[model samples]
Target: MGTKFGSVIHRADRGTFRAKYTYHGEVITKTFKDRLSAEAWLNGERSRVEADKAGITKWTSPTDRKRQEAAVKRRRTLFCDYVMDEFAPTWLNYATDGSELASGSKRKHREYLQHLTHSFFWKYPLTSITTEDINRWLADLDNFGGATPRKKTFQLLKAVYSKAVAEGAVAKSPVTMKAPAVPKSRQAQIPPATAEELQTIYANMPSTTRISVWLGAILDLRIGEVVSLQVQDWNPKTQTLRVCHSADVNGQLKSTKTATSNTTQPVPPQLGKLIDKACEDKRPTDFIVTCADGTHITPNRLRDHFNEAKTKARRPDLHFHTLRATSITAAVATGASLKDTMQWGRHADAATSIERYQRASGTERMREIANGIEDTLMGHEPTREELEAEIQKTKERLADLERQLDALK
Candidate 1:
């Protein structure tokens, strides 16, 4: 009773069965201990050959299948390789909005990528990384210190995976963690420099660089914008200072931080005169503020001088940006509307001007408010001088209203 199975022969002399299959002009043979085992082996080989013919499988031979798998493994992208080789190179070229990132922003992304390389799963294949791996990496970021850095690193990592997903490298990202909260230290507002503090700092600054303080505290220009001011960017006739460019961390000239940051600010008479003096005997392309060698001053150098001046003024807490805060706060104190203050500060929105720059009312403003309340309660009569001032203000208001009505007509 010889077993009858395709390509399976009962070798009675050897007490075994031989199973053979031909695939792509190659033969595969295996010996089984019994007829049942041989039949099963032959059936599997036949099914595999059918699958190959139907284009369901790429290889029929086991060695060829192993080779195909090895080739696929070579094509897998690792996390570190994708970041360093592909993403980092083009990150600064365009932002999410398709605009070139500011140099400072580009620099920060480079730093974030550097930090990501330190993660434990940097060597893992992009598709193989799991949510548990991301969470673990975030836990390790705690040792790197500060919530801000951790948050930024996590965001960069998410962006990397997002790029991978967009390119069809993976079905989805594994970065499932919510964005880290802002640190409490950053949430607390630092007070703007008071009038007395501003004056003291101004007096302490060297005469040559005193205009930098005015630029910050009066025009509300950022440190980068201050250093990037050229003679052509100022208009003496209109008393307007245009902010079109700013210095990056490396002191390289780049566009302003945001589109709204490129604004023309109306300069006060005092600051305008100071600027005129700074621009004396200089070309239209010369920097408004320069070092002793007549070259544009770097932000670091300006900060060094500013730190010395603030220290001497007994306001070590006053950062360079505190001067900008002082300017916006002063504008608001002068009864400037929210929209006006937003334009004056060159902020993108009213909320940023109010929440980030404006500070609580100072002692003088508080006293003025209290005095007005007291006068109203006591029914204080207006003196002759006060009455004259009120009449003048009323006349001006009526004239302005008439002009607006005429324009409407």
Candidate 2:
């Protein structure tokens, strides 16, 4: 039986006091160690019991001594209760926006958290989680595959721990305790097409799909942007295609992948004409590119059909992202510098696109310059007979100019 009186003596833990009473139906006896706190609580209980005042606030536990023992046992045997239960929601959302993860990155985070709970992190109090534990997780993650997943797993760990730090659930994240050394996976950017190859590709597809993907790769629009292109999004007067909206799985309005994604992409004259054709005789709400069923084309379906075009063109390596890669290549070839490529790609990150995607070594650059010079000089070189023909043509042009000048006089 629990003690009816609420008197409590302060324990060695200082703040905790031991008291026994019926609190809310449970006979919870734990430490309620503070003197003033114990007295206030006891008076409240006495008022409720003696005066029959049902409105008095109830104490946390019916038996305070037993609760204190249970708490001590938990602390001695358990390592898991570091982060408070209430702090999880904010931390999950933190992984999405604050971390700058890839699309659907939350799914990966859930996996990491689920794994950590089953691993040693489950028992280690969030405050007590050490650098060794994080490194151990990294070691186990590295055994799975190459650099990409290892980096992904490391990032997930950082996010979850960082959240605990922010919520005051831990003194500091073990993530910050040690630097993790991870090898970078250099994603081999697909090479862009020469003008001739593009002409070949553009020739194969119907005007609508060909130009749409081509413009997308050039603009570096997110896959969602490709599907949401509308007739009104094109402004021929400005020779620009606006990216005003993006689609979800259900083809509804959603915020673009990032703020940078909502941008205007300059449409070349050739692509502008294709947009016009797709929009020809269509309503304002009509789409630019559609499926066989006349619904807007999704990114997955676009990539599938784009592959067929690549196959027919005898270039099997090309993919949808390749189009954007090729566009940056073309911009570079046209003397659009690396900084220009970043702008076109809408990379909010300040690094030049050449660093991220394009790699033009000094040797390759000199070769390109040599080839350009050779092509220019070779195209206009004059042979002996051709020189004589040019002399005659020049005399005729001079004579024509003289005639025009005299006629004007």
CA error at residue 187 for candidate 1, angstroms:
11
Q: Cα lDDT for residue 267, model 1?
A: 89
In model 1, the Cα lDDT at residue 152 comes to 81
Over 1-409, each residue of candidate 2 has an lDDT whose tens digit, in order, gives 1235655656765667765555446553445547666666766665655543354544343345457665555445333444335434545445344644334445555555555455656676445668887777667653535555556556656766676567544556677544345553333445665555666776776555676566665566666677788888887789898887777665665556655667887877766777777788777777777776667777777666777777777878776666666666666666776677777767656644655444533346788779789878886556899899989999999998999999999
State, as a TM-score between 0 and 1, how close model 1 is to the true structure.
Answer: 0.63
Model 2: runs farther than 4 Å from truth? 1-88, 94-105, 142-146, 163-172, 176-187, 248-253, 336-339, 348-354, 357-363, 366-409
lDDT of 1 by residue, 162-224 (tens): 987787667788888898776546323566788777778888876667689989988888899
Tell me how far candidate 1 lies from the true structure as C-alpha RMSD in angstroms. 12.4
Q: TM-score for every candidate vs. truth?
A: 0.63, 0.62
Top-lDDT candidate index: 1
